[model samples]
Target: MTIRAYRDADLGAVIDLWRACDLIRPWNPPAHDIAFCRSSGHGELFVAEAEGRIVGTVMAGHDGHRGWIYYVGVDPARRRDGLGTALMAHAESWLARQGVLKVQLLIRETNTAVAAFYERLGYAVEPRLVMAKRLDRGDGQKNA
Candidate 1:
């Protein structure tokens, strides 16, 4: 597979891949997330393609402090073929070029398989709580 930056036309295939990988949640709508990343200009979305198909994707960027990765997904049938690792490597390279010092990503507490995969990539568990407040609810209203 070849790793490359995301394009507008890749939306359908990317969302389908994320769904197949069980990466979508009701609270985090895929289309909104995609638009945010595309416009944020802080991070990049990388997709892996093989046989003219999008097989994997990763969103990575830094905020001038540290780098973060999100929405990492690989096609179920395409797993175990090093596609995820390749995508990550591409992300890291992209971040490093931007002078990012540290890279971090979040894995659901119950996602043991995903945690293991990250561990294999030399990412360790950090003892920190991730707190967040949703600023935009897709309704042009802030949460009260």
Candidate 2:
């Protein structure tokens, strides 16, 4: 299989693979395709192709300080073939190139298997809480 940077033409297949894996989270809206493709940073979306078909995908983005790994997915039929690891390696390499000091990702608390996967990958869980507040249109209008 070949790993390469994503083009607009690969969006459809990438989304399909993600949906098939049930990997979409609440924060990942349907419009992430547009946002991801247009984002400017040290990160990029990559695809793993085999036989002219996209089988795996990952989005890796980094500022100078930290890196994020998001939206990683592998086709069910193609799991256990090391595609996930290969994709992660590519993402890490890209982050390293950008001088990012640390990489992090958030996984659902219920997904113990996923946590274990990352643990096996040499990532550790930190003792910090993640908090967020969604500002609605009303709030924006008030500020305006």
By TM-score, the best candidate is 1
Q: Report the C-alpha displacement of residue 15, candidate 1, in angstroms.
A: 0.6
Q: Against the hidden reference, what TM-scores do the models get?
A: 0.90, 0.86
- Could you tell me the TM-score of candidate 1? 0.90
Whole-model lDDT for model 1 versus the true structure?
A: 0.88
Give me the overall lDDT of model 2. 0.79
Clash count per candidate: 0, 0
- Each model's lDDT comes to 0.88, 0.79
Candidate 1 residue lDDT tens string, 1-144: 688899999999999999998898887888888888779888899999999999999999888899999988999987898988999999999999989989998877667777888899999999997876676565555322
**Candidate 1 residue-wise lDDT at 79:** 84
Query: Model 2 residue 50 lDDT?
Result: 96
Window of ten residues with lowest summed lDDT in model 2: 135-144
Q: Tell how far residue 116 is off in model 1, in angstroms.
A: 1.2
